[model samples]
Target chain A: MTERFERELMRGSLDLMVLSVLADGANYGYLIQKRVRDAGGDMIKLQAGTLYPLLHRLEADGVIKSKWDHSTGRKRKWYELTPAGRRRIRDQALQWDKYAACIQRILTPALAALPAK
Target chain B: MTERFERELMRGSLDLMVLSVLADGANYGYLIQKRVRDAGGDMIKLQAGTLYPLLHRLEADGVIKSKWDHSTGRKRKWYELTPAGRRRIRDQALQWDKYAACIQRILTPALAALPAK
Candidate 1:
């Protein structure tokens, strides 16, 4: 796997990615991981170990709240975004956009100077 | 402190904030902590306990490489961004912008609908 993809996936920014997914509605940990993998295509795959810690962190921060559910005849934590969490999702999304644009501007010249494919 | 500021300062995303400061040049941990506080203009102050782990993680990820320097007769770990580190910094800055923008767009309406302050 390319370093870019690995760096992005491993950097633990997955909290925002997971929050984006949960923004739609509630989801269990396994399903959230699956959704990130599916959404990111083959380029990014989130591991369970990373996902759970992030979920707990988000919950601890009160950005996202969770409750135990027995939907599958086994207990699982179902997470959903709270109003605060929703606001955060929006704020973080905006921050990411501006950040991406600045980086793109910086990279454009470098990319242009690269040898042709 | 407002939840917005606290939330931003916490959640351990201090990594990026630190990287942004170090982008100028190599700096020791204590100086970095001081710089972030000074740069943030009292809005954000990075604690040493939180700062060290983030520095270590960044070093571990190879986004930043560090060396111990003896200055003022005391040893300190000084960190500088690597080429790969620079690239990741740029990428992350971009991602944060995009995330922030989308959030701002969503919040505009909500802010507008709020009663006048």
Candidate 2:
């Protein structure tokens, strides 16, 4: 699939996905991107344009908090989910699961009805 | 999950899912909604506010076409996938598969890393 298409699919759920990663522990921007890529099997990567704006929005909305960490001898903005963010992630994850299951149900039968290749 | 949340998750994929359902056979709005709900295990339902606009938009885009069917002694707008809609469904289904696989990969590891409940 084209990167654009994958990105589009990722658009709506990006916030929840990011929060999910952060739920494990706090992470810096680059590391967050790396984790997502590693988990996506290298097929999905976040673009700076999409990532930064979302981070900013999440921070502004009080869903996430950021602080500069210089413990590694380099300054990086580290992000973690807030209480609200954690709640949001839970709700979003549950919602995603239900949504996916519903869509799968709708598609499976229709797909089965297709003529065999 | 709230209907709103499910709808949000459905936003990006609504068009493609609808096309996929239509790809199976021509259907009217209520039936289309029924098919989706039945397949979604009744957990996911489409609102008229969302569904009608999407249908209009797809029709305008020439991805789908609608005609009035009076066979049941009632006038119902039946929608069928156009050739473009069919092709779009193929592309979208492939994209959804790849995107889902990628997200699953990322989420699985992060989720596994979380402390046991």
Candidate 3:
């Protein structure tokens, strides 16, 4: 896929990706976006507009918490997963595994079924 | 977890969950919410306030397309994944698997490491 297309697709799945990244340590918005892009290779990148809204929403939902940090010369909002957030990422990961397996089952056709009955 | 807490956690992961749910077939908002709750086994439920915004955002992003259906007595918005969305869910699923594996690595400790060298 083109980088643009990949970016858009990535936007749809940003929350889980963000939580997973923050699972490592606290990070500010730009750094998180950069990490996702770097980690995703050339396939995905996140726009600030999309990323900020998701970060704000996650904070509002209490999955992740943010605080202003002034250690970096200029103040920046840094985010980290709350205890609730950590558990949430774990639960969502489990759910995603089950859901993906179910979808694969539906999508996969038995080889025997390929021939006319 | 309480149903309420599960619902909130589910909110954080709703987009991927929604696309996975819709992969089965097109469905209206209420039915989709019901299916998620039923499939999730009391672990997840979607609220309209949250669901509507997500649906609208997905529509805006061209991941899922929606239409108003009037056949069910009341007008309800129904959604289905676009081809782009299908590809997106697939990519995101693959990325999530890798991300999960990495996190698990960070979390797991070598048994020998428990004792100081």
Q: DockQ of all candidates, in order?
A: 0.08, 0.45, 0.09
Residue runs of model 2 more than 4 Å from their true location after superposition? A1-7, A41-45, A60-63, A70-74, A83-91, B1-4, B41-43, B70-74
Query: Worst lDDT window (10 residues) for model 3 chain A?
Result: A108-117
First chain TM-score for all predictions: 0.88, 0.90, 0.80
Top-TM-score candidate index:
2
Show where candidate 1 strays beyond 4 Å.
Answer: A8-12, A115-117, B1-117
Q: Quote the lDDT for B39 in model 1.
A: 54
lDDT by residue (tens digit), candidate 2, B1-117: 355455556756777778878878899888887776677665557777778888999999898999988888878999998777767776777677776766665566655665543
Q: Per-residue lDDT for A5-85 in model 1, tens only?
A: 344423524566777777667888999888777765544567788789889988989988899988777889999877787
Order of quality (TM-score): 2, 1, 3
Per-model C-alpha lDDT, please? 0.64, 0.74, 0.64
Instruction: Give candidate 3 misplaced runs (Cα > 4 Å).
Output: A1-12, A110-117, B1-117
User: Per-residue lDDT tens digits of candidate 3, residues B23-108?
Assistant: 77788888877766666554454677877888888889898998888887889888988877777666655654554454334233
**Per-prediction TM-score to the true structure, in the order listed:** 0.52, 0.80, 0.49
Question: Whose lDDT is greatest here?
Answer: 2
Q: Is candidate 2 or candidate 3 better by DockQ?
A: 2
* lDDT of residue A83 for candidate 1: 78
Task: Note the residue pairs that clash in candidate 2.
Answer: A102-B40
